[model samples]
Target: GKVPILLPPLPEQKKIAQILSTWDQAITATERLLENSQQRKKGLMQLLLTGKKRLPGFEGEWETRKLKELCAIKTGKKDVNEGNPDGKYPFFTCASEPTGSDEYSYDCEALLIAGNGIIGKTHYFKGKFEAYQRTYILSDFSNAVSVSYLHQFILYWLMRDIDREKQHGAMPYIKLGLLQRFNVFVPSIEEQQRIAMVLSYADQEIDGLEFKLNLLKQEKKALMQQLLTGKRRVNVETEAA
Candidate 1:
């Protein structure tokens, strides 16, 4: 038995191919922009968060304080199995993204750090949310510290510190004591806010680039389906004239 194939006229086929090729180029350019933006943010975080490069009009020695001095640290009561996909609030575990949950145990501006598995991974959330038993929540920030700045600081430093703690033959994990004793370089709240704002702008740029990339890819996919299946036909003769 011979299979039937739906093929368009040569002129129409060429027009469709040209349209898809343009989409491909746009998607590739957006992907490279997204990558470059991410790397730029990473570099900015290292410099501004560490006080190695100061923003204009700010000059002073930063204070070094232990984590316990800046905020209260505690763990969540819920287990990983308790998450609900259709629930109302965020359920944070040791993973990268939060799942949905019906119940929330804490309500505040807080930083959540994974205590085990993927040790040192951190998330900052404000408002009501549930958390896994092993996730460390840092809240009740001191007046002198900016929680936003602290979150950025931990994002850059804690993971690097955790990497050094990984022993030969042992699974890496974070202990309460390690967090309690962890040191942070604290600038005045004003300087902290300034640095955090610059980094936040960089994040927004990266996000915009990523959204554009997704839209381009999706448009190309839908166009391919329509053209290849003959659901949409190109008017090659009109375009040529």
Candidate 2:
């Protein structure tokens, strides 16, 4: 048996190859930008969350406290199966996007953590939201710890816990007791606000880059459809322009 191949004329095939290669290079460049931005975010988390880095407007050492001391933790009342697709409120089942909810269990600035499936994932949101019974909700933040700062701290350290869990090869789960005992470093409320602001800006920048990447991908997809089908032919001399 012989391998299959496209039978376009040599010149036309070469033109198509060159055009596709250009698109591939563009996509690869945007992908690299996305990866770099994500890495920068992780680096920022290490420095800012640990109090190793500080914003210019504020200065002070961070306090050490258990996770429970910063906020209260409780599991949701509804099970994952209880979520309704057409409900009005946001209903979180696990780590991914939330379903719709007719009612909400809490309405505040809170952190949502997965307790079972795809565990250790976390979400922070303001206003009303519903959660699965296995979803751990951390709300009623303490005055000593800024909620956003605390969210960052958890986001930073949760990676370590995830890595450790991978070593065990056991099902991922977040025990309420374990979270209650987990400790974190906390700066003054004002300093926390500044750190959160900086990180928020970083996230926005990364998000903007992602949007551009998506547009580039869409453009390439449309271009391929036109070029491959010969609906929009590319002139070899156009490359010079």
Which pairs clash in model 2? Answer: none
State the C-alpha lDDT per candidate.
Answer: 0.89, 0.81
Which tens-of-lDDT digit does each residue in 100-214 have in candidate 1? 8999999999999999877888989999999999999999999989887888889888877877667553446788998999999999999999988888899899989989999
Over 4 Å off in model 2, which ranges? 1-8, 236-241
What is candidate 2's TM-score against the reference? Answer: 0.85
TM-score of each: 0.87, 0.85
C-alpha displacement of 78 in model 2, angstroms? Answer: 2.3
User: In model 1, what are the clashing residue pairs, if there are any?
Assistant: none
lDDT of 2 at 16: 81
Residues 1-241 of candidate 2: C-alpha lDDT, one tens digit per residue: 5966544567776788788888789889989988998899989988888767777776766678898888888999997777789998899778577788889988988888888876777888898889899988999888888788777777778757766877898546777888898888877788888888888888898998899889888988987787777777767656520
Candidate 2: worst 10 consecutive residues by lDDT?
Answer: 232-241
- Candidate 1 at 15: error in angstroms? 3.1
